[model samples]
Target: MTSPLFGQMMDVPLLASSLLSHAARHFGDTEIVSRRIEGDIHRYTWRDCEKRAKQLSQALIGLGVQPGERIGTLAWNGYRHLECYFGVTGMGAVCHTINPRLFPDQVAFIVNHADDEYVAFDMTFATLVDIIAPQCPNVKGWIALGDETCISTHLADMATPALSYETLIGRCDGDYPWPVLDERSASFLCYTSGTTGNPKGALYTHRSTVLHAFAASLPDAMGCSARDAILPVVPMFHVNAWGIPHAAPLVGAKLVLPGNCLDGKALYELMEAEGVTFSAGVPTVWLGLLNYMKQAGVRFNTLKRTVIGGSACPPAMLRSFEDEYGVEVIHAWGMTEMSPLGTLAKLTWRQQQLTPDEQRHLREKQGHVMFGVDMKVVGDDGQELPWDGTSFGDLHVRGPWVIDRYFRKDDSPLIDGWFPTGDVATIDADGFMHITDRSKDVIKSGGEWISSIDLENVMMSHPQVAEAACIACSHPKWTERPLVVVVLRPGATVTREELLAFYDGKVAKWWKPDDVVFADELPHTATGKLQKLRLRELYREHVLPTVDEKVV
Candidate 1:
């Protein structure tokens, strides 16, 4: 046969232009809405968003934000941050998203370390700025995002050239001519939550991030489309809200943003008013809505689906939404290294015939890999394990969007072609991947596996439990045991016996925590993750369970 390699090599542009361009081209008139603090609805379109992104690029350049220079944003998910995301990356500058949930000191550290020339933030973070601004020495410009009238004036001694959001964009010519960008050029940088150590930057290239957005938009993945109105409850700062904004628009989905108003009433109100069909967030955020539903009805007739990630999703939460509210929670798992999307729990057609209860059981697993993702589980000895689901081992994955290597650090997690996800997982015969725990977070009790997260999930299922954390405390007889630290709902309480009984027949009896302690509130990391390690340290000395307690 004639050499087909001579056929013209397919050439596709690497810039994020694909996502925005597709939306602006076909879905120009589709609505992209944002809910406001004063309970107002703001509506625009893809073309409007594209125009704003271009204008913002011109605005940044006008304000001395030259291409290739780093710009930072400590903001919420809304049209403004969306503009900054594409505009900054499109202009050939690196957009660094600072997790506002990060401690003020860590925020200052990241900004200064990235040598950010400018910072744009939503109105709600004015106080957060007050604490971190003094330390971000390289930030030369501060643009308070929103209408000029809404910006606060309690500025302290922080020295930075200030500009109003509207004024900045208005100063620029609406049309922006972007430079040709290489796929390898750094597009954006998102730091890990640094729960285990100092936060490190994961530099994303135009090629990697663009491909990830496309992968995320796939039907088996987020399954986003223009007809779908998505509310990404996850913060814009966290892995680009798990890449929802980037991918949702590309898939032609209407994005409804709840800016800085993530509480239950705020979220439910936005979801209700916007007619949101899909939403995504960590389990903690949704738990609030569940609580709110009990107090005031949760009418989510329009909301049929939501993606739950950034920690394990309680099976009970999944079953409750499916049973009560008629919503499906897609439990996903991934990390910063994988562009933060590894798996999604959507079932195949063959499994549809399964009973609802059986389906719920399967849906609790992490999920099968998306189209381009390849996965495996290996032992500590670096040997591959069978995907029998019952076999426990460390999980590994490799994909186009997976981290080739850390941005500046040397020790790589990749061996051969795979990147160790640092999560322990098991894959059943049907290919459903179940994450047992983060390799670092696993608890070895009497040489038996005791999933801290599973116990925590079961704990949070209790009506009186607003939130819960289960951590491994050192045990004399068993090298480790689960300690349940709980945050109770206001005006609700359950005795220890009552709470433990909630898990009866639900989980193996041995997996139950030896003791339970109630707390006014659980400690959270900057990214809103329960600080489980801290909880373990706090309760380390309390040896309430005797060796013979198992029999009792």
Candidate 2:
């Protein structure tokens, strides 16, 4: 018998260009504010952005950029960078965002690996471009992300054949048409930071990007809307700035790009100037802003909600933002492999109906997965663990936007079609996933496992502690024990006994840190995550207090 079915539906492909077209047609007048690297505020509208992006498309075509050709951008979050995002993708070329924070050699490696034919960069990276350009011979030319005067007057002595971005676009007639490209075609490329090894590029499709934008714009995700002015302190090179560059336009929200200046004072000033209502960035950036505000006796004038990711957000940071600053902190977790947005900490209705303290506890966890993501924890036997909130295992996730394989690689990183997220986590009965530790960061004690994240969270909650990172230190009896390296608040002092006493009733006695060492500052990765590998190297030979015969 023939299956019963409804009438035929339209099969329009979801493309990234459609987003820009929608914004241009409906929200053309929406603002796109940027703090330029030249120490000035540059303002424009979505209409202007659309026009210039089209002009950029024409310029690239004039430069012999073919469809699917890789175009590299080593710039910060700004109007010009946004134009590159649309211009490159709209014309069916892949937009490869190279992280300038990566080592010069690493940057050259990524550029050469991607086989990028063209590069565009901010003036701040002119010297960096000069160093890496010689190594990246495949790069056809460099386009400075500024006007002719800014390039000549500022970067006059640069040896690269750098063209002015404005000049390149000005020569175009702004009449380029976006091609009818396949939805599954590659649109963007972002390389992993290579913390463990060499960086691997993750090529994303236009369809996946559009779907990610839709998921991020929903209320359960970023909750972006036209009424909100969004500031992305995260740079464009990192997972497309957590996909905010697309989400903002999808929802018609005002875009505020914080160019080269990510310092707390600069961020605060730009946020206030733009009347930013929402923002997304790492925990370290927010900590700096909070500290500056506390010292200056100032508060967020218009900023309301912030999504803290790139690493686990401390409970103290969350509480401070909600209690003292009247702003909400949403703890998000993701990786470059997942298009950088896997989970967000939005409370469910049942959880929200609970007491404020109960809700806060729920929020402290990573919360639940968004609409487009499927998550599960699996044991070593490759069996799925129960969501009882106790069985911690390797976290694996699969989604339309998730990366299945690295670019230029034949082997796949998927197991049973799900990408292993490299996170050890627990899923509660309500579907809330708590990241206990990274797969490599989890401390394996004598025979049991200890959660470094739990210990670090407790230590950070202490009033005197500013930042904390727990690493497994070698122990004679126990296979491994946690040694917490901490950075105390300015002018704050605390003894090791007092700090250990603070954790007395908080965690298990065996889970207690073996030692507490203080430092003036802690090392961090380019994306603001604590560099635990460096910490491990620094404290590899650190011996516990030695006693006569007991070795205590």
Predicted structure with the largest lDDT when compared to the true one: 2
Q: Rate the local accuracy (lDDT) of all candidates.
A: 0.82, 0.91
TM-score of each: 0.94, 0.97
Give the Cα-based TM-score of candidate 2 against the true structure.
0.97
Count of residue pairs whose backbone atoms collide, per candidate: 2, 0
In candidate 1, what are the lDDT values of residues 166-237, reduced to their tens digit? 788877766776667888888888898888767888888888887888888888888888789999998889
Taking the tens digit of each residue's C-alpha lDDT, what string does model 2 give over 54-87?
9999999999999899999999999999999999
Distance from true location, Cα of 409 in model 1, Å: 2.0
Q: Which residue pairs overlap in candidate 1's backbone?
A: 101-526, 226-252
RMSD, model 1, all Cα superposed?
A: 2.5
